[model samples]
Target: MVDTVNDDTELFTIGELARRTGLSVRTIRFWSDSGLVAPADRSTGGYRLYDTGAVARLELVRTLRELGLDLAMVRRVLARQATVRDVAAAHLRALDAEIRMLQVRRAVLRWVVRSGSTTEELRLMNKLARMSAEERQRVIDAFVSEVFEGVDPHAPGAHLAEAMSALPTELPADPGPEQVEAWVELAELVGDEGFRQRTREMAVAGARGGEQQPQGPDPERIAEHAGGAVRDGVAPESAAGGEILGRLIGPELSAEERVELADRLATFTDRRVERYWHLLGVLHGRPPMPPRVPAFEWLIAALRAHARDASAS
Candidate 1:
């Protein structure tokens, strides 16, 4: 039923209300018909007449509509079915999600432009950007599971399995193009059978519990010695290289331990595995660590040379 107006309240026709509120007559009539802004009374001529309070209501409706509220939600607000505060909160959440999606899309498109991506690549990146957090996590989880399945979790270097598998529960809400690219490349790397086998070799060697297990090396000494050797072009087989190795690992070591250490390092040293951690660090905003594989490779070669020389003597 239409609301009645008291004699104390002044009424305005639809045309008059439109002029006062700076809204069009057709819009006021449409809103009136939609029950969002109803007439307070009707004249004998049956023209819609609204009281002073209708002006305020019409302004509220116009403001709400301009702010992207559909007629249905506006009607609910007018009918007291939901409060403006509650509706605003819900809309805020929706807007936040939309904003995040737009940010990701912007980043992805920028990457596409910068990279001159092919059509298939564009399609793949778009699909990745649209995936939910859980979906992204599942991709990593499945890769980790396949690589480490049936392995003894408590074995040596087994702890690395978990660390290697650790992916953020979600990408950052507004991930950069490089981060997205990291994820895509990481996904592809993890799916490669050769890469999987390499990782498995390391895991199995670690699980063997002998001298074949992976070990941590001091980064500072390696940078000083092995890294310096590479910089100075000191060949791994040279006498100078042997002296550098002695300083790094100590001159007192027996040939057998040297040989065992060399074998153990060979089993675990993989450029791709190091790359996986490096990519993850980039994603998580960590300071970039210098590549250690080359240094270690040199060390392995030097150790093998010393073992050979010892055997010859």
Candidate 2:
């Protein structure tokens, strides 16, 4: 049982009600005087008196005050100018936006420290914070449309075009500086002649060679030999390489097949194709895989070595 100085039915003094509600006496007085909350009746001496219901009302008032509502809004709430749920929902959205901005500020500070950034960089970071969700999408959309505009969705090359154009349709209201940098770098990378050529070259090459684009280092042999070479750090052309090669390509398989795989791997092993994938991973919020170029390059040489052995035989 809640110990009340006065029972719910009994008229309690304003001071007693204030103590029960944990509101300061002056605040309770102000609310009563403002016509926001009124005592239930007059006491024996005409002092303000409150009934049990006043305790519940006072609790609601305190809640509104704690939530940063001005008295006017509080009164509006009490009077149903707007429903509490409606006002609360709106405020909740506003708070979410504020929290995102603060997170972005922290990221920008860290980026400034990491890059030894100049004032110009600070300005850029600040500017990035001001971008709305729609604005950010526009930036991504424009870049992607330009890069992949002509690609026919029905064509074999359409997949590459689609990958290049994929962007986050929604960014957090306040995106961090790293997100901003990624956007800028991505825009620059897509525009870069080297990167564009690299993507186009790989796409065109994939079309030219289809699945066999990297032949001698065929899928089965690569996952076996090159994959193992990457794991064991073995040079493809070493004298001991024959053992690894034998395991990968099969001792029964002719050296000519290995050479064919190697030549194909070399054609598509350019770093740009890897970077295109890397950027795509970032857009998709994925962790990255290790580079396999060294392993493939090794496989290419091993393939060539197998050719030499076949020639000598």
Candidate 3:
């Protein structure tokens, strides 16, 4: 019950306010001392007293604190220095960033468990996973810049440099295990000196090919016929393999041309390079494409085999 301070005023002791607001007396006392809910008056025995308005103020303070507002922010809100909506909006953005960070850490842990990563590998994975989107893009950009340095952009396959450097502007706020794994592998792949040299070779060859029209054989035909031959398990030296090669590049080419085609194909093909694209696809949420390098390898072998037979004759 509230005690009457005068005919026109009524105030409650700290215990009475706690009972009314369902808050602890200690909490109320703390806020009162902090000047957030100032006492309206004092009692004869030197006890703190709060008018009815203090009870309402305590409820607002409780709500703000429960919503994760710090004491300074709570004070600001009570002081009308900021509106509740403005404070909430700012808090929401902070919460989003925190949530995204937690998601990335969770994904990294999940990948670590699946891969049984060593201490160094785990450390690397965590570092890469926690990088900001801009930092991640820089990783890819550096790789592309070094590999394609001085290579003509208009070259036949030089466009690949653009695609190679393409990483999503930001990883999904909640990336899955596959994406995390892909990112880690991609980071490692780009950092390899051997891979960089191989990619540069492809870029230089592409620029040379661009100097002439009709860049090598038709990739589609090779993928279809040569890919089919591989699927059918046809040996490259077999007569049956020659038939597929004919369908792939036509029977009009001479032994010299066949060897040239094989050399050209070999220059552009590497399983690790293909794996780079596969990882990119995983990160971009693209459907997994079947490996096409084996098929191309078969075509290269067939070209070499047939050319050799003709030279022997």
Candidate 4:
């Protein structure tokens, strides 16, 4: 029943307000006690009574609460100390960060399942995969910095070191399984002391050779001729391999020259180093390039073969 405070005004008791607003009497009493939905008057028996404006305020408070706002935020909204739009914008940024973290966790779980990772592997993968973009970049930066620490910055390969350290500005907020796997593998690769030493060797060599134009066989020619021989399964030490090597670096190269060229090639051609570039390609959303290390390995072996044959003769 409505309490007629005047001819024009109708007031509702707690029970009546609950019936009208579809809220519980206990909830209405709590909000009233909390000063969010204050009573407009007191009945003769000392019960809480609300006017129509209170009913509207109660509905607004319920809507805000249902939207995940705490009582304090709702109070601010009700008091006009903060606008709903401003609160919503702040809440959205928080929700986005939370969602991104969950997505990364999901991706890590997927990787764990697919790889059958051990406890230790899973722990490491999770730690690497969940790092922020800056943290991920720092891992690469540290690796590159160590590898090129004493190497000359003006070296031809110094640019390559910079390229090696490149990471996307940020990882995709919702990364796929492959991306997670790439990041984990990359982190491990950079941390390997053996790989770091190999890279440093290449950097130092390139710095030493930077003063003169490289007189080595053309890379394009090597990839074409040597790459073909590798695909065709031609034995590196066989006669046919000699013909390909002639077309590659020219038969005029002395035995010592062949050995020197082979050593230089071997220093830079590493499967793990190539794998590093391949993994970086994956992270950068590039299509996979065919492995070039095998072709180069064949070239190195063939050079050693002919050099050894000449020495024996």
**Candidates 2 and 3 compared by lDDT, better number:** 3
User: What's the best-to-worst order under lDDT?
Assistant: 3, 4, 1, 2
Q: Give per-residue CA lDDT, model 2, range 1-313, as digits (tens).
A: 2233345476667788877988889999999998778877775566787778888888998898787778888899999988899878877887876777677677677777778778886786667544555776666566555545555556554576666666675444455555656655565566577666555555665554346455343555666667777788787777767667766665545566666767666767866667656765664667887676766677677778766765565
Count clashes in each candidate, considering only residues at least 3 apart in sequence or on different chains.
0, 8, 0, 0
- Candidate 1 residue pairs in backbone clash: none
Is candidate 1 or 3 superior in lDDT?
Answer: 3
Worst 10 residues of 2 by lDDT: 1-10
lDDT values, one for every candidate = 0.81, 0.68, 0.87, 0.86
Error of 2 at 64 (Å): 19
Per-residue accuracy of model 4 over 1-313 as CA lDDT, tens digit each: 6787898888999999999999999999999899999887888888878999998999999988887789999999999999989988888887887788789899999877787878998888789877887898999999999999987787677787788988775667888889888998989999999999998888777777654324667887888889999989999999999889878876567789888878878888899999999999988989999888898999999999999665565
Instruction: Report the number of the highest-TM-score candidate.
Output: 4
Identify the superior model by lDDT, candidate 2 or candidate 4: 4
RMSD, each candidate, Å?
4.3, 8.9, 4.0, 3.9
Worst 10 residues of 3 by lDDT: 208-217
Query: Which stretches of model 2 miss by more than 4 angstroms?
Result: 1-102, 118-152, 172-184, 208-212, 215-224, 250-260
TM-score of each candidate structure, all chains considered together: 0.73, 0.54, 0.75, 0.75
Give me candidate 3's TM-score against the actual structure.
0.75
Q: Where does candidate 4 clash, by residue pair?
A: none
